[model samples]
Target: MKHSRILSRATAALALAGAAGTAAAHPGHAASLADGLTHPFLGLDHLLAMVAVGLWSARALPAQQRWQGPAVFVAALLAAALASLGGVSLPGVELSIAASVVLCGALVAGAREIPARAGLALVGATALFHGLAHGAEAPMGGFGGFAAFALGFTASTAALHLAGLWLAARLQRLPALAWSFIGAAVGTGGLALLAARL
Candidate 1:
């Protein structure tokens, strides 16, 4: 019933969810719809960044502008993911992914007012890295495998964003305060991932 309790519970839930992520996604296991659905949960970085985007959207953008950022993000993500099929791979994807998580946290924690266009651009830019990472490593099992994998991760990403939005709206205090804590946790997760690779 207390706001602090609610926030703590929410934060713990997110941390537990992050702990459940794996290092890599293998699309060979994603031929089924269920397999694809679980693909985005494969990495903590993906989980944090995706949800952070939604949290940022709810906090920074107005009601009319909220959908734009997320829409652009999804489009940019698809482009980068599809590009990986052509063998256009990015170096330092892990680091880039980690950085994106950090950036997402900063943006959510700050939650400054910004133009919708600028916000959309920011969301789109970071999403490109996340998408490319998944696309490059996606298993080449033909259209069905690729489709399932793509669909799974995409849906999962959307769900995470919604969760972030829900949390942003539900917190009793300033959204930024609750989000700042979440951001800190997500940033910490990114640091751990970066350290693991280095």
Candidate 2:
């Protein structure tokens, strides 16, 4: 694609991101499909990590199996969220989540350096942590409510992954410096988030 098209897409994506309603990490807010849809965009950690997963997959995986990364992540996220609803929980979840952003950003930076299987494993593990965090803040209603919220968030997360993939596709023509800058910004944001949590 031409630079103009790429820049247009980027601008549109940024506009949408800016326009979305923001949710706090672990807000403990009421759960609904709407809330769930907006949940992934609530925190930069979640947004950045989720998008980075897509970006890494685009850079690291063969075209034939590129979808696996997002598939595994979505599956793990849903499964983990369900597990949380079943009264299971993990400790140190917040810190792990923050670290996931850092790791994901790094993964995107050096996606080709890691083996594909290793990358998938890492992405899956990161999704698990994210799922646990999302589950922890599920709505207080019965399973029905949780189900709605889960559906909403799952859809949104998948969309974000697609957005990342699209962005990565555009990045293919850009110079290495562009990738490095993106990775650095993402990693630095994660670090800031991690420090705040500490």
Candidate 3:
């Protein structure tokens, strides 16, 4: 029942963000890796999911296994970016990326820990979708710049995850509830981003 409620809310939220721009939307009227570097910051869906990767990693795995989750996500992200560069296309990339935000946030809020292998699979799968979405949005005729953008976004994503991981680690030390609440906030923010589209 609880899962259903969260799913519905997440679904509703994705529906909202669904209407937002479907593309990565960058390097227009300018050409630089800097633009690509800042692209993820341009959208809430991307931003939340990237950071949630970090948060989910911290909460879902043991200390030694934490880095594994982000690693898988990033590797897959790079592959997807390459695929996009090669002119590959996938349907519903935007919606899937948004759904990742919902799922990652939910995982954090629930404090559901799982095996490292399983966690890596989960984050990796979602990351492929995200990579493809970002790749698809790369500026045409600017592989060098787009590569920079890819590097930019990938680096940004890692930083976001690190931020999440660090905060959660600190929060886990406190008696007060912190990480769980932040997860809820992340989920809630995702919903708003989705809704803002409508």
Candidate 4:
């Protein structure tokens, strides 16, 4: 019960912050850099996979391993950017993004603790697909606007990971059913993304 309350409060706080961020990003325009930044957050597959990175990171190692998670993700983002600049033709990028959710969720559900290097490699590879999709999809515009949007999106990703960490911490005390539910939801989101791709 206590854990549930904490989760609820944390979720509420994130929602409020996300709303504020959205408003700041776009005041009148139906679409803007903020929207671009938020595109991933609006999708369950993206949200779950990003959060799962943090959750799995937490479960895999001690607090000292914190940097590993974000570092790997950033590296993946860089790879994706490079791929976009090179005009790499990656087929089924969306499917890969969705599959990331299922893969990461299953890792967490199984409580698998991979080696640090191996884990980072896995995350980096997955991030490539995500980053490429975003890069390819971004509207051509001013570099300044693009930079801002990217920063906002990155910040949002971090926020989501924080939320996931908080939830994971609380869920740790609960029965396995709660964690399994999270995995199921993430996997379902992956399937939805896959179907959309079809």
Candidate 5:
């Protein structure tokens, strides 16, 4: 429990540092940089999905398996970056991202005890979609600014994952139905985003 708390605090601090870096990188467009940095956090569909990654990781494995979760996440980020650089055209990326939130949340709520390798596979696949979206949407002209934004966003993601870990630890005590409701909420938000796009 103490370890979890420490991790959570560290994640939050990293998030703040990433945001600061982004701000520093774009001095003339502080507002823009802030907005860019926050773009990933604003939408419920996005935030929930990212958090769900962590939650799913925690619930799907023992404490010893924790490292795989972050590793898969980083791998996904790298894959997405590569895809973006390669100019892959993913038409429904935003909607797919929204759906990932729902899917990952459901996986967590179900408390599925997947093998570490399977969990990594699932996360890596999802990361590709997310990474592509992030890469495609990145600003073209300001590499420094974009780098800062990416750093902040990545930090925020890690923090949310930590939060998810904390939440999952607590939720383990709750009824399964209650957990299902959490999944339903996440799914509902994703569906709403999908609806909006359509």
Candidate 6:
């Protein structure tokens, strides 16, 4: 019953986000709080990577350390976004973000094989690129506007991660092979997006 409720909520959230409109590669559609909240949903790469982080966390880490993955990712994401505001830059942001999807998905698929700390590190590192991409694309604004956007973005991102974690929990009933297949699918999707960008 609890599992069903969690799944239902996650599905509802994804459905609502999917209804938000077309997904694009950082078109800078709008810089408002709404945009920040919805921006991660607007991009396939961001959505996949964020969710995969949660999935990987739940799959690989012990229950006690599960929060570390999301914490590291969110911190890195915010740091990179803030750094970009200060004129810091990372080359090939789009490519890296795409790669994050692929790598994160792969991690989910093979969560048992990798060490927990290594997985956490990879998540944090890739998040930097995501942060840079989001930061770079966001329009210039005063501190107030940026702060609002950041708050919304951060909240939305954490929600997505929770969704992934919930999904992982629900999937525990499934065979390991099934979980691996899902991860492979996500990785394949990332590859397709990467090819499009390249």
Model 6, position 9, has a per-residue lDDT of: 62
Candidate 3 segments exceeding 4 Å error = 1-30, 174-179, 196-198
**What are the models' TM-scores?**
0.84, 0.86, 0.76, 0.75, 0.74, 0.86
How much is 175 displaced in model 3, in angstroms? 6.6
Candidate 5: misplaced stretches above 4 Å?
A: 1-36
Better of 3 and 4 by lDDT: 3
- When summed lDDT is taken over every stretch of 10 residues in candidate 3, the lowest stretch is 21-30
1-198: candidate 1 lDDT, tens digit per residue? 577788788677666554545364433334555765786676777778888888888888877777666677788888898887667887887777777777777777667755556667778988998788767756667666777778877788888788778877777365456667876776666666666566
- C-alpha root-mean-square deviation, candidate 6: 4.3
Q: Which stretches of candidate 4 lie over 4 Å from their true place?
A: 1-32, 175-181
**All candidates: CA RMSD in angstroms?**
2.7, 3.8, 6.7, 6.0, 8.0, 4.3
Residue-pair clashes per prediction, in order, are 1, 1, 2, 0, 0, 0
Q: Please give, for residues 4-88, the per-residue lDDT of candidate 4 as tens digits.
A: 6754564444333322221111122223567656765666656767887877676665777765776688667756755664577
Model 4 TM-score relative to the real fold? 0.75
lDDT of 1: 0.73
Candidate 1, residue 77: Cα displacement in angstroms equals: 1.2
In order, the Cα lDDT scores of the candidates are: 0.73, 0.79, 0.68, 0.63, 0.62, 0.79
lDDT per residue for candidate 2 within 1-198, as digits (tens), equals 576566556534533442342334677764699999989878877888888888888888998887988999999999888888888898888888878878887887778788999999999999998898888888887899998999999999999899889888977776655565566556666776676677
Model 6 clash tally? 0
